[model samples]
Target: MNEREVLSNYVYQIVASLVASGVEQVVVSPGSRSTPLAYAFASTKELTLHRQVDERAAGFYALGLAKATAKPVVLLCTSGTAGANYYPAIVEAKYARVPLIVLTADRPHELREVGAPQTINQVRLYGENVKWSAEFPIPDEAPQTLPYIERHTVRAVTIATTAPFGPVHLNIPFREPLVIDFKTQLQRVSFVKSFTNDLTPSKQTLAEFTSIIEQTKNGIIIVGELPLGTDTKALWNFVRELKWPVMIESLSNLRTEVPEDCQVFAITTYDALMKNERFKRNVRPQTVIRFGAQPISKFLMQFIAQSNPLHYIVIDEDPMFRDSTHSSTHFIHALPGEWLSEIEISHVETELAYIEFWKTADLLAADAIAKYGQTANDEGAYVQLMLESLHEGTDIFVSSSMPIRDIDTFLPVLNNDIQVFANRGTNGIDGVTSTALGFSNGRANRKTYLLIGDLAFLHDANAFVASRYQDCDLTVIVLNNDGGGIFSYLPQAKVEAHYEELFGTPTALAFEQVATMYDMEYVKVTSKEQFLATITSEKQQSLKLIEVFTNREENVKEHRALWTRINEVIEQWLDML
Candidate 1:
């Protein structure tokens, strides 16, 4: 076989192995050096190929697919800065434990540091962010080249999907003639290697955990952002058996899935309730057991730091120190499902008074929010209405900054199975729209909703192009305060001279024009009734943009006023306690 034939066969083997390893989605960014692998992936009958023009958006797009599917999604890009664009997504995948297989095309050894057109350091490009990284050799006519490529391809897929799942990078270098002729029929190869890891804790460790649970009288369960594909039912049962007050994060998936009847112990509005200094001081637990990552609520973090419990145990699959407050007394490295399933908890005869106190506090907070939401004309009220209007099983992607914080603070106790997602891994607003679209594409059966701010919407406007081409079932709710609304809550809002220019940074772009340019169905709602009517109408099968305009000053004021009301309600409840 000629050198071109060898390169073609190598690319074919890699793609086939990936398919056999159960990667069904591949996102390819257009480039010359990656032509061979991209064409090979496109030719494969079992693979779904998604084409994207921007590498940064493409990376997050693939991240969303993997997040939704709980499988590895392949990412293909050309050499040079094209590979660098994948860094943000890789970091997210690492922290969020999403599986991704990143394939970047590169120049051969001779082309390195010699002023090649699209050449840079491609080896270990992502640094410590990736789970594994490697540089593949340029395909040659040697007999063993194809087998080596096939084996490594399977290995990369396995690593990406294993425990502590994350992105794995494979820098593939190709020589000249990076295209394959149709006349050369490629041979199919089978890879039969498999990897498995069992991270079940020891019997002694489970006994120790059970002892810890039984000894504590007043304990709290803090649920953070759970890994994708986690058994929410198992989590609910575990919390129910413990009979402890459960503070669930909005993205934890537990908050939306738990039945209202079972939510007596579930504190869904802790973010708002903890803001009351009296409530924070009185609601203290003797023991604290945390699961998953740190929560999105800064108030909860501060509360944990201030109310340091005697036994603060953190249960995580990975051994990383996810505790930012440094208050954890013990870090138990174990899968939450496995640990909860194996450990035997004898019914502890602890007082139900503590749990009842939390339930009362949560109810009072909800009542306060309802009172304010009836007349408040601000972003918090808008988020509450939007969340209540979503149908069961809706996949909602919340953008960072104001949208996520608003939902955490004001969203009501949901009876439906609404799945919430966000790019909280790195918490940047660069690819919010594209990531939501990718998630919508992965979960095509469910209606998807993206709650994003104006600045975040504009930051990822190119994602609308991808959405238009893919025709995802998505409703983009743009909370347009015309600028960075979240900045008003920060200390910089006090700076009168440069607040507008430096922090506010208002952009007067009309999103209706943007919607028209992207051919999306557009609606501008000014009142709460109009907004409710729009979301409750017949769901669209194509992309739609709904804009709700709010004033930054009014939004900030409304939030402060709502919190003040919540404090008053809490004080009343405390008097009864």
Candidate 2:
């Protein structure tokens, strides 16, 4: 093979190997330093190449893809600070436990900071944010670095997809010999799965967990955000025997027929239980049996920290906590499904007062929501609309801040088959759209629904420019309340003049204009009924931009009104007691 052919083949070999190893999505940023890597990925018909111009956006785009697919998505970029641009997303992925495989091409070590353009320290530049970082040093003149390149690529891909997966960086230093022809390159291929093996709980651990469950009849199960394809059946099997109140979070894909005896919305009932004596007695579980990753609400975390149940046991693959409070009585370091599979856990025959009491509270809350939460006046209403409209088994991605909070608070995720994801690790608003679009490329059959705010949508409009979301069943709902809608609900809004100018800098631009610029099908809806009827239709192949018109000022007013009413009810109940 000639130099150009060798280069092209090498790129082909690396991307093909990644595809063979189970990485279906590759997000590439247009850059010269990494032209070989980018070209190889783009030419491959087996792997889906998502082109995002901005390196930072591309990084998060890869993160979103990985989050939705539960597989590592590769990110390719040229040398210099292009790799550095991925740090924010790196931190977000690290905290969210999503896998990101970053492939950055660099100049040979000879160019060592000697006043070279776009040359900064690319080695370990992201610091501690990434789970693993390695460098593949290929000589510019030597043509026999193929074996080393193949080995490192395979190893890097493997580690990135392992359990507790996060971002892994493979900084490749390409010498002149690296820039070879694609057609004449030799292909050394391996079909190894780049994924973590399921770790089952030991017999001893299962018995220990069963003992804890048997000791307390009034136990509560708190399910958090589970990755896609997680075995919810194993968890349901164990929970069924307990006859306990299994509390499902918005993201937890716990869709096996929930036991009739279980309380569906236990996390939201924390405030009422704390204030009402009768309700507390009836609703408080003797033990809290927690499973899955971190729940989204701060209220739930604070409640767990303060309430401190009689026996708290967490079943998960990673022992790390996602919240500020860190106190667990026991943590079973195994997949919840695997742990439950081993234990012959029998259901407790004791009466569940907590489940019965919370059932009534859940009913009351649901009724209230049904009655008063139907308009496009609040963020919660947007969530309710999307949840009611989106297709079953749709992959929903929510941005950080109010978008995720609204979904967590109101979206009634009844199907375990449908996947839901959010950038919750660091909870920043950056790259929400890019990540969602990147994630959609990996799904062959499933459609992706990305619900974002106008500010976030505008911030990552570059994502739309790249045509990555085109032809995918990708629907982006921009809840255009205009300029930082969440700020109106925050304390800053208390000062009207300062709030309107600084915090709530409402942009007057229409949402349709954005869709027009991106050449997407745009639909504007002002009412809940219209949104529900329109979104549920079975349609695929084009990007649909649904712009929901909402007023930030009105949204804040409704939120405060609800909080006031809830607080008043709490005070009245307390006074009566």
What C-alpha lDDT values do all the predictions have? Answer: 0.86, 0.70
Q: How accurate is candidate 1 locally (lDDT)?
A: 0.86
Once superposed on the true structure, which residue ranges of model 2 sit more than 4 Å away at CA? 1-13, 43-45, 140-144, 177-179, 189-197, 255-282, 346-350, 374-376, 413-418, 468-472, 495-497, 529-541, 563-577
Q: Per-residue lDDT for 241 in model 2? A: 63
Q: Poorest 10 consecutive residues of model 1 by lDDT? A: 181-190
lDDT of 2 by residue, 158-186 (tens): 77666667788888776564454445433
Per-residue lDDT of model 1, residues 1-577, tens digit only: 8767787788888888898788999999999999899888888878898988899999989888888888899999999999999888889889889999999999989999999898999899999999998888888878888888888988999988877888999999998888885454445656776958666667887788788889988889999888777777767778767888898888888777776657788887788888888887777788898988899988888988889898899988787858999999988776667457656788675578878888888988888887776889998889989877788989889999999998777666677888789999888898888888889899998988999999999998888767644666789999999899999999888879888988899998769888888778899989899999999998554878999988999999999998888888888878886
Runs of candidate 1 exceeding 4 Å displacement: 182-190, 539-541
Candidate 2 at 239: error in angstroms? 1.4
